[model samples]
Target: MFCCYESGFGKVNRFVALFARQSVVNEPPLGASDFKAAPLLQTHLLKHGQGGSGSAGSNFFRALALFGAGASGLLSCATIAYASDEAEHGLECPSYPWPHKGILSSYDHASIRRGHQVYQQVCASCHSMSLISYRDLVGVAYTEEETKAMAAEIEVVDGPNDEGEMFTRPGKLSDRFPQPYANEQAARFANGGAYPPDLSLITKARHDGQNYVFALLTGYRDPPAGVSVISASQALLCFVL
Candidate 1:
């Protein structure tokens, strides 16, 4: 038997059972000699709350309703499960424009140059793009001499001397991007216990990488009514961005 709850109307566990009891499975087929079976089917159905004659049409419709309710419940459960999964993994940000490969769709070189400038001027103060080197920008964004010059502007830590002491030297094209903090502890201390994430591969790590970054950069606003605000430190980070 099926069970269903109806708000302000009590439980309805007996609906299916009642229908089953009045079902016409055991009844013989209607024939000239078996005219009494029709009345028997009607009598059985009437006992189950179906008023008047229990025609095949009425019984079929009742079954359909029961099936529909069960299916709806299953669908609702599946939807809830899907939503839970999304919440567990964190909600995805809205998609925005990204570079694509096609005849008309290509990386915006001008935008890339401007964005690189922004990263170097603003974001590099806290975040690190350690996976990339100055040499990686050649051809895609910068010329070989420009990339080498940019690398030379930074001082990088190098090998120990014969006396076993580390030394600093001009950064080379092969050297990884420099970091603002020496270690994780220093980073946390500088940011009030919040360690900035590395920006290398960030565009690939997020669901809608470019769009998510753009939204985060510009989406700082008062949350809607009933929305709980984030912690003060995180809120501060958002505003700073």
Candidate 2:
């Protein structure tokens, strides 16, 4: 027997179970067979709930739901449980049809450039992308010349000079992105003892990170009353002209 819970009301797998329990329910199926089956189906379903041996109708539909859920990852008991858990710990994310999605889709270069500009202006104040370098931006978001110019805007620490002294020079394409703070201790001190993590590690470190980040940027809202107690998703990106 498949155990499940229905949230309030919906016309789905839950509706099937709910319908089975009903003495009479309106269903618009185009056939005399549906009418013929309802009598047997109702009898079997009602008996199944009462600890009697279930009939083929109950087993067949439940099995169908299980397989469909496994394949499509929806309409199963597990989906509800997972959603409830996420609702407890985090805000629900609204879906958006992002341009750069799916097998045939490619990155939106102009939008990416704008987003990168925002990251540099605002998010760079707290987050560091230690794993990424300026060269990675070349041919992706910005041209080689533009990236080189941006790299040169920052001063990078170079090897010990002729006099055995470390010196700073204009940053090169090879230099890792500059950090917001000099060290972990400084980072903590500046941010109320909370060390801002390296944004470069987000994709590798977090499950479903791309969606998570997108959610974090857009998931500020009041959850359904009494349904969830949510924690915040921090969004540091700021879009400015």
lDDT of 2 by residue, 99-217 (tens): 77788999988887997898899899999999899999998899999999999999988979899999999998999999999999999999888998888878567445566677666
Give the C-alpha lDDT of model 2.
Answer: 0.66
Name the top lDDT candidate: 1
TM-score, cand. 1 vs. native: 0.56
> TM-score per candidate, in order?
0.56, 0.54
**Model 2, TM vs. native:** 0.54
List pairs with backbone clashes in candidate 1. Answer: none
Cα error, residue 76 of model 2, in Å, equals 17
